[model samples]
Target: MYRYDEFDATLVAERVAQFRGQVNRRLSGELTEDQFKPLRLMNGVYLQLHAYMLRVAIPYGTLTSQKMRKLAHIARKYDKGYGHLTTRQNIQFNWPALVDVPDILDELAEVEMHAIQTSGNCIRNTTSDQYAGATAEEVEDPRPYAEMIRQWSTFHPEFSYLPRKFKIAVTAADRDRAAVKFHDIGLRIHKNDAGEVGFEVYVGGGLGRTPFVGPTIREFLPKEYLLSYLEAILRVYNQQGRRDNKFKARIKILVNSEGVDGFANLVETEWNQIKNSGVDLPREEIDRIHAYFASPKFENLSGESKTHKAKIAEDKEFARWARTNLAEHKTSGYSIVNISVKPIGGIPGDISDIQMEAVADIAERFSFDEMCVTHEQNLVLPHVKKDDLFAVWSALKAVDLATANIGLVSDIIACPGLDYCSLANTRSIPIAQRIAERFSDFQKQEDLGELKIKISGCINACGHHHAGHIGILGVDKKGEEFYQITLGGSGAEDAAIGEIAGRGFSSDQVVDAVEKLVDYYKNNRQDKERFLDTYRRLGAQPFKEALYDAA
Candidate 1:
């Protein structure tokens, strides 16, 4: 994790002071709702369907024990007893009073965290692969570049207000876990034949009313010109991106309108002037930022853990968990343990204050006092010893956190839908709860094998429904909640968008619809094909027939 420097601390403190005055003015009635809308939004405060919601940034989804404890404190003091981890890997408190927002910001500043640029059409939080620093397959840690971009885009005077919200993701690994292709700007970091680091930049990818898989604008942008290249792309979009209709204002639409060739030409023309400007990254500066993410110390241990094998042999439940929850770490004896937050029938990403504290304790005890938040919305202790599996699982089970459903049918990615979100047309949490309850049988879930079920309240794809093997989108039809299902989508090395199966189902029928789809895949799939492979080979037509057979 990148520790806040003096400049970072000073800027956040100043923003807190500035927002305090803004909150005071709004409450004093000096600023009406109309007048306060933009101000509050800029500060990441929203007057949602109910009370105000505050989204606090968890930059690149990395958290310290201190920071996680601070979040627990904020949850207990400000709104509710829980905080919802969002699709972007940030956390949101759904029920905060507007008057106490400045105080919340003050509390956040205590931990060197804030809500700046988290909302209001500005460049949002820069997201990277949640497993950035720990994954065994990574070429390098991508967080330093993410941190640099975060600072540069925080309040870039030029892009503070744009046609629509802009998102950027960087991944240094060969596999794309950050959903980079679905971002406004996606940077794939690589080293050229000359052993020089650079990025392959993709632009105009986004998911909203208009979803697009971004196109490559620059095949290889040198490391020094990364920021400048980004500036050029945004500069082109900010000036010429549509503003007439909010629906068509995204950079995706702009790129589509101009065609990839025309857009590339525009960016090239703009980049030529700014490539070697003040923003050009120096080698020393990149190395300095990279220093913060250096790997933790590890003991020299053998390839396999005899203790771990013994534990797995002793406990079947532990074996199941170990199989699903543990990921390979770069080090020989260390493992990346994903402490499942999705207990059966529990909210997908809601971690209570006690759980938060427990996680902090575990991070300090088991990990090197570090944790990472997964894109699937799970907490990760990145450097757990292979020998500590049982101890970690035992501690996690005590807190009701050990649910062996990682990558299984019950391991769903869901948003805090209509229940908390004003923008939602229907409830997503209850739907997710229903699905979990339906697949209550762990044996059945394990038999069904690796299946991803993602739910979203709206078409914004916050739940990443577009990338799920089984995608569920909730819509409201004449005051009744309905859900639409899509299959075959994936967010992995072989990424592909999901295709809708058929007509939408009522809330009650949605779970049954999902169950039917799984059954069909089970009966039709080849020997070891996952649900995605089955759907791809069979296509939506077969699934569509099966889904709407009796309709």
Candidate 2:
């Protein structure tokens, strides 16, 4: 993790003082609700349906034990005793008092964290793969690039107020764990034929009222010109993107209207003028950022852990968790452990204050004093020793944090929905809870295999409903909530927006509908095919028929 320099510390402290004054002005009636809207949004404070919400940015989803403990402290001191992890790998406090927000910001600054750019129409937090440097398959660690962008975009006067909020994601792994394709700008780091590293840049991919997979504007951009190229793209969007209608303001809408070729031409023309400008990252600067993300020291253990193998054979519960929640590490003696926040029948991504502190303790003790927040609403102890797996699992179990459903059906991604969000039409948490409860059997979930269920309370797609293998969207009809189902959507390397099955289901009927679709796939799938694979082979017709025809 990167420590804040003097300049960074000064900037954040000044911003907090500024926001504190602004908050006081609003409370004193010097600024009305409309007047305070932009100021509060710039600081990541939102007036939700029930109370004020504060969204704290977890840059590229990486955090140290110190920062994690601060989050636990914030959750305990202010708000309720828990915080909700967002699909963008941020955390949200849904019940903060309006007057307490400035104090919260001050506390966050002490830990080198802030809530800036989390809610405004400016550039939001740049996210990346949770297993960035530790995973075995990455072409290069992408966090340094993400950090560079974060520095460039933070309070950049040119892009402070765009037509709509912009999101950027980067991934270096073959598997797109960051869901880069669904971002406003997605960057894939890879090596070229000549073995030089570069980026595959995708623009205009987003999901809201309109869903799109952003087209690649450049097949390969030299690593040196990364910042310059990004500047060019943002310049093009800032000058020409829609401003008349809020609904049509996103860059995705602009990309759709101008076509990929036209947009690419504009960006390339802008890039040609600025490609060699001073904004182009110098080699030393890049190296400096890269140094912050260099791998931690690992003992030279030449083989797999004998104790780990024995433990798996001895304890069925630990064995089940290991099989589902662990990923291979580049280091032979270490494993990447994913801690599921989505316990069976619990609100997806909700971690209590005690759980946060417990995980932070475990991270310090077992995972090199670091933790990561996954886009799928889970936590990762990226470098756990294989020999200490049982100890870590036992610690997590004591805190009620050890649930083995990482990618299974019960590992749902859901938004706050009507419970807190003013823009939501229905409740998303209950739907996720019902579905998880219906499929609580761990054996059954594993047997069904790799089913991703995402739910959004509205069409905004905050839960990334468009990217799930089985997506559920909540819609309002005649003042009543109804759930709509989509099948075959995926947020992987081969990304696809799910297609709608048919008519919507009542709240009472949605869970059973999901069950039917799962049963249909289980009965029809070819040998060991996942839900997504089977859906692709059989198409949506069978699943649609299974959901609607049987209803």
For this target, which candidate reaches the highest TM-score against the unseen true structure? 2
Off-target runs (Cα >4 Å) in candidate 2 are none
| Residues 450-541 of candidate 1: C-alpha lDDT, one tens digit per residue | 89999999987788888899999988888999998988777765666788777799987898888889889999989988888888888788
In candidate 2, where is summed lDDT lowest over 10 consecutive residues?
541-550
- How many residue pairs of model 2 clash at the backbone? 1
- Taking all chains together, the TM-score of candidate 1 against the true structure is 0.98
User: In candidate 1, where is summed lDDT lowest over 10 consecutive residues?
Assistant: 488-497
Candidate 1: residue 486 lDDT (0-100): 81
> What is the TM-score of candidate 2?
0.99
Q: Positional deviation of 468 in candidate 2, in angstroms?
A: 1.3
C-alpha TM-scores of all predictions: 0.98, 0.99
Best by lDDT: 2
